[model samples]
Target: MPTATADVLDELVRASALLTEANSVTRLIAAMVEQANDITRSDLAAFYLRTDHSEEVSFKLSYRRGRLDSPKELATNGELVEFLEESEESVVLLERKNSPFNELLLDSNSASGVALPLVTGRSLLGVLIVNSREERFYGRARLQFLDSLARIAAGVLNNAQLYRELQEHARQIEELQRYQENVFSSMTNLLVTTDESGRVHYFNRAAAERFALDEARVGLTLKDIFGKGLTKDVFKTIDTVEQNGQTVLGLEGIYKTDEIDIDYSLNIAPLQGKRGRHEGLTLIFTDQTAESRLKQEMKVVSEERRLIKDMFSSYLSEDIVKLLVENPDLVKPGGGARNATVFFADIAGYTNFSEGKDPASIVKILNEFFEEAEPIIRRHRGYLDKYIGDCIMAVFGVPVDAGEEDTVHAVTCALELQMLVNSPRRTFFRGEAEHLRIQIGMHTGPVVAGNLGGSRRMDFTEIGDTVNVAARLEGVAVAGEIIITENTRQHLGDRFSLEERKPVEVKGKKKPIKIFNVIGIDQQSA
Candidate 1:
């Protein structure tokens, strides 16, 4: 062989080795095109791979020697890529002359060129091209050398393409797996997977905190996380799912720790393989401890509200119920010593009126009398504490602000009760109750007022010497008369017409208690 021919053959061997040894198609094509350009002594060389086998000729991979720019413009040369794909032959242009291929590379210094399709096993993979500034540089011998190089590289290029596609598919699968794992771990609900033998395999962050377990608990069994009792429930739920592919839902269980008890709703489903065979079990746990506690608290609060409404709805105004509801601390079981007025009202001659009356008749008469008097106590902002038979006990300045007018309200309530009793239209037992008279007594002093009773039953009332003095004053008052003590008289502040009675000795007192009969509201004050 001549020296030039020998060098060309050696270049062919090197090109063959480079194409076969390259792990990536890009590296192989780039090296191959560069070598082909040098061996042919051309100004430019490029490789264009056909992207799709369609009427629209499109090229995807384009690499040009020493030019980082894409060959998109050259590839769009519909006439050129079509000539290579359809003809499956080489095109040789010996002079810078008029041709559709030459017009495509108007900016090239090329005067002559050769284009050969890189075909293997009847598949046209791409086209290789060489351009030279000198005319007729690629004669019969050089063209033959280029043809031999294309033949040597076709099969290797095809394999490298397949390998690259496989690599990209693997990378995509890996990215998809990472995305799925991130979504699973970020959830707040407890998630865990168990094997067929009930051994735990996976646990997320929320599962760790919920079960009070860590990564070390991964290999533990169901019995390990929850003791025998709860584990039995877990297994039973899982068995239900495994039997007929039925989902077990809303199975609530309690998991108690040293700090608090956790109530959780659970769901169990089968972990199935691609062929739909049951591989294991997937357990989903939703923490409902806070929600359950809130529901219980709401239930208690609702019950309390209903009870308060039922107890006071007959007499207390809606505004008072609303105030007590908003400020529950005011009625919660505790008492404070405060200056307040207590009122006691009783029916005169009750023992004689009840002698011949049946038990139901006596109760009916007492209810009628109290029904007429309770609203007057509420109107004066006095809480009607209790009804002792036909007697009414009311307290002012409790569970709310009664202001400085508490004493005035007490005496005013007494006067209103007497007026309601003396009204002619108000009849009981067919006018037999017409002769019934009311005795009213009120006193102001330090009294302890609060809810007093067991947890199940409670009464809001006052207890102190003040309550006793008021009750005693009611006993000494004659029919249709309202009497009050010295303490209450001071707080009246000229609001009522008072009759100073003789000093009277009373039980629970070291001295004679000064008393006054409240005739009526002063005309000026009224």
Candidate 2:
């Protein structure tokens, strides 16, 4: 109706049209601030808007006269402090608000000021200030004029702010895409992502190049990879993870593609979905060169345990040694967690016999003893957990499924070890033939299990009352003996004649465990 309202209406019309065509919020805000300044007839004008990064608030200029300065990039902290405090005030005219903008306007330019806050629910989105050089610069005509302009401009600026934020988000996403492309394309390791149902979602460029894979074959199921027989380890790891919900990583295995040795180390992890759901799996597969160095290191580490297992098998059982080797991750030291069984064995007179033999011969004979004892252990399907000196400790149903024959297997291995020592192999171990004997003590019970180590060195081993009692029984056992515990006897369930031995206290065990002499099963009796 009035000139100011008419001019304000014109700016509102122009702001709306510019907003409609504006692809970005920055452009829209430029339109809003520019039109607001024009209609208010201000000599100088600036607008500051706020954004949140968590609880902390920072300011970006929504619009300013300097086109070269990105209004969005300028930090407006400590600049318009009091101006914001007075947004609800009917007016703040030509008075400093203890703000830098107020002081700067007074110092650098003789400008009278009119400032207002853009208030939304007690939060200041921004402030707009118009400055003119002439005194009594704003009348009721001018304040009404600026207020009219602020009203229309505020709504337009609100829309522009939304548009700008959305545009900035789109930009961030594009940059992230570029980053992903750069990383994925150049990675030396194979990278793959699969959907919730095991369907292929992404395979990096390295994976494609390493496999010489064609696009026609990229998005198929794991079955397709197996159909091509690209890798058995890949399919096996995938199947294991899918079936068990285990996140497995670092699987190193050789790939035989017509005798071209391809070694791969695979890392498999579950992909989490929105809301912490397991969506699928992602894999990073490293090829042979790095794998070889790692294998060398691992081989060195496992070498001692492997040797210990090899020698222990001579006196104990193959099943147990295999168990130790196959599931090293299963046996952790000092865990006190019960698994399934505990086993112990010792070479009778091993300590005394070693005194007479040369060091090399002792090593050789011990090795031979183990070689002689290997088969009977495997026949029983058990795991040899560890060996102490000539003593061999083994257990069934550990690190893997232990069949029902655990007791029979232990008995059978004992008999075989004795029988083997009696053979010509016994001739090579004349010391064993002359005096030394072997004893096995087995008890089925729980033992702690997990990876055990210090801040640095560690070993996977079982330490519990079960393990302690088993070792005690083995220590008291007479050589060439097959002694089992009451628990093992029960597990054996009369399949073997376990002649009751007196309850004996083993070291570290609070109470004595019932020990027995294990002999003839039903098959043995027949």
TM-score of 2: 0.43
Per-candidate RMSD, Å: 14.6, 22.3
Cα-based TM-score, every candidate? 0.49, 0.43
Overall local distance difference test of candidate 1: 0.78
Measured by TM-score, the strongest candidate is 1
Give the lowest summed-lDDT range of ten residues in model 1. 66-75
lDDT of 1 by residue, 216-307 (tens): 88878876776633656667667778787787889888767575467788888888888887777888888897667778999988887776
lDDT on C-alpha atoms for all candidate structures: 0.78, 0.65
Count clashing pairs, candidate 1.
0
lDDT of 1 at 328: 68
Which stretches of model 1 miss by more than 4 angstroms? 1-9, 20-26, 49-57, 66-72, 75-77, 96-109, 119-125, 151-164, 195-199, 219-229, 256-261, 293-526
